[model samples]
Target: MRNPKKYCEIWKLQKSFPSPKGPAIVVKDFDLFLRDGEFVSLIGHSGCGKSTVLSILAGLTTKTAGSIILADKEVRGAGPDRGVVFQAPCLLPWMSAFDNVMIGVDQVFPSAPRAQRRQIAEHYLELVGLADSVHKMPAELSQGMRQRVGIARAFALSPKMLLLDEPFGMLDSLTRLELQQVLLEVWRERKITALMVTHDVDEALFLSDRIAMMTSGPGANVGDILEVPFARPRDRKAVLEHPDYYRLREHLIGFLEGQDHRKPKPVAAEEPLAISAAVLSPA
Candidate 1:
């Protein structure tokens, strides 16, 4: 068997915040390694610092400890090499869908001719099934359409890594499924390394090469990492029929259930307060 090439590495990542009551550690000793063109999903209970991990990986948040190495370079801050799609579409109100994607392409490929940049933008938009809505504003588009613009904009950069923080958490079931398929198609085509923080177990099973299950925080860490054995061009119906699917599903569901029953440590009066999920910024 061929050895997988390492693309990104996270070692002993930790994050903490100062609270009035004490220093609350939200993430502790979290570690993960991604191979080139691999898709990994981080799954955990709400407030288990899932988004915090992504934020740190995106260079949006500073880690209190450990290291994040991408392509052999230490990640200190955000760069064009990493593209992030948040829960909200975050499209600029005035920019049309085409213009929105163009901004990212221009930033990442500044030396390219203007025509080429525009073409890149248009190509990604079409890939996401938004060819006709290229000129539509965010307000004019449906929620799902707006998110599609965001996805296109991110992919237009052709980043080495993509960070997704619950990008489909807000959509309706049908729209979520549709966007998931679109995202999978794009990922298959580009094969970019992706790390997504998702609460959906089925979504993780459908999309990731491996699922990193985290324990509940006041210092959450990876509790289990499960390899997804399903073949590519994965069909939802076919996935449901696979015998291991239910076994994996039940394992993930049971893990979260156990996490839900674990209580967080209490904060002391003299120390800084514990970091609540509300305080952490969305990636």
Candidate 2:
């Protein structure tokens, strides 16, 4: 879509982290822009630093080089303006689902009254189809259910941008598909700018407006940004039936397969609020 006010930008980005053997793992030049209300996916081999990029965006990790700009403003540190949903759900095992989501809302709006925070948290939980599970603790919920909480927490804050790092990777095939649909519905309803890191080609095609393909390893950089021209309210089965679907899918598959044959790379290394109190705090 056309550029708008809520867009997120990553300019000439580069990063490095301490490797087991020596200095930090080096990530070469990278750059991209996330338009307001756009859904984009970052897809690449395991060592391509996708998660590292997410960390930088989250302000949990510092970049050795480059800059992140959100809505025409340079991003210097973490704040409620951006929300992140991780792969593991990262919930507190002892806290109930409502409390878990409440934590994030709290950070973003610390001064808001308790009742307001509770309402926001519950609303997001309901949006993610987890109204009944609000009282259940993380330990009591299934993996998929736990992930729903993570999604609920992120969207509850109404941040200008949402970052998802393979949040559905741990779920079964069917559950993953269900969550995918849930996420799409939420995005359509909210129209929040979203960036997701995923290895699943089908998932990327299903969820993203554009897919950024990255190089294989060690010094991974953005290789291509392919736009998904499929019509809005996309049909999974019908899209698959379309001749272009396979072509797009194959192109992504070929890039990933080529990365699989590349030399190995070094390893890399690495929240929130209660109701109003949670959303505005440091992660």
Candidate 3:
């Protein structure tokens, strides 16, 4: 596929939290960009602040400094246009699968008729293979099934940019592969810009158009970028068989290994979203 125009531009990104010792800087001076409707992944070892970047983009977590521009306007806080699926499904337990998804669809399409909103929710739930389980409550569903609902909910809003933070991190190997395929099928149809954070290299390789490598933290930032040369509309089998697959894989492994020596166990500090009310608003 030909290159798409610049869509989401993140420049000089920085974040820090107050520490007993001092301010703990997690990310600093991070710069990156995504083409319109492109699928990109931020890959790094744990504690590298990859999730921090995604949260900032989602407006769930506020940045200490810098700017994120999406769809031509500055991103001040979370809105319906950017959909986020975190490591955990984060669904409301009381709500049934259909209602879980409807929460977002209703918010995003409030002007539409009630029947239209129901149609939108059912469409994405079916798209994610949850058509049979639409009425099940969160406690009644398996972990993978819950994540599927989260994916469906995110897409139900018809977001312009989708932010995923280790979306498959909690699943079993078999289930992980299953969800990966499901995610791609839905994404292919939507053609929305997506940015995912993950530590799994092969998972990144299979799903991303380009992978951004981050340096180790206390002040993590972009180390390098690898363009995934595999043609789009891809499948796992074809990607594994493609020439140069290992070459790209090796480069990512090599970069991470080099950063391992400096990698401290990630800091366990959560800062209050105590900035502007815009910072505390949900994405």
Candidate 4:
């Protein structure tokens, strides 16, 4: 009856790193699809190539094989359509928070007037509760504040997708939760598609529409995809109270533990492993 809408698709994605010993495959046959305005999280053990997948999707790192299609266009390299925030804030030490954000807005909206760009930057900074710190440099801001600036900068670009690689991994638990709330608020308002790579199960459950569990690497792919059944805008307390929350949390933890026990496969100089259609299903 109705045609399925595909906002972003990753087909048979693969990535590898060369070494004297052999070519180590970091990601193999990673396949995923995101509908418009959906938020997904990738969770796996450390070094499972979770970040590699995000980098490939962001066009920051080239995939050795496969393709990434966004809005029906093949991703070639870093483009304005995708915005990234990494573990470290990675802000310029010399620039003020406002300036750092304005630079990105300027790049993405060059045709707009300077005044309009400034307004856009201010709007996002204010959205992230950084309006007062707009003039402060990265060194002057606390770790959490600096990360907020990074978030503001990314959002100001108005990208079609937001790629977060453990953006809150470096913060304290309290700060991490606070930033999560800020991110949730913005995401609810903008409804931008997002893919986050995180090791935090609670964070993933709290923020994602679906969680993609990656298998262990030298060649990792999505081993399972679990939908988050909680309704949003999600309240932390309420989500914890939901029966499915703990069930899903336990399931994810169990999956990670299982991966820990599996013997890692040796690196091979051949094509990486391919993900099966069944494993990629969002059900």
In model 3, which runs have C-alpha deviations exceeding 4 angstroms? Answer: 1-4, 263-283
Candidates 2 and 3 compared by TM-score, better number: 3
lDDT of each: 0.88, 0.81, 0.88, 0.88
Best first by TM-score, ranked: 4, 1, 3, 2
Shift in Å, residue 113, candidate 3:
0.9
Residue-level lDDT tens digits of model 2 in 184-241: 8777779888989999999999888999887754555677778887877777787778
lDDT of 4 by residue, 10-62 (tens): 99898888888778888878889998899999999999999999998888899
The residue ranges of model 4 lying beyond 4 angstroms of the native Cα positions read: 1-4, 270-283
TM-score of structure candidate 1: 0.93
Model 3 poorest ten-residue lDDT run = 274-283
Candidate 2 stretches greater than 4 Å from native? 1-6, 18-24, 264-283
**TM-scores for all predictions:** 0.93, 0.87, 0.91, 0.94
- Please state the error at residue 145 of candidate 2 in Å: 0.5
lDDT of 3 by residue, 206-235 (tens): 999999998777667888889999987988
Candidate 2: 10-residue stretch with minimal lDDT: 271-280
Worst 10 residues of 1 by lDDT: 274-283
For candidate 1, write residues 103-158 as lDDT tens digits: 88989899999989889999999999999999998999999999999899889999
lDDT of 2: 0.81
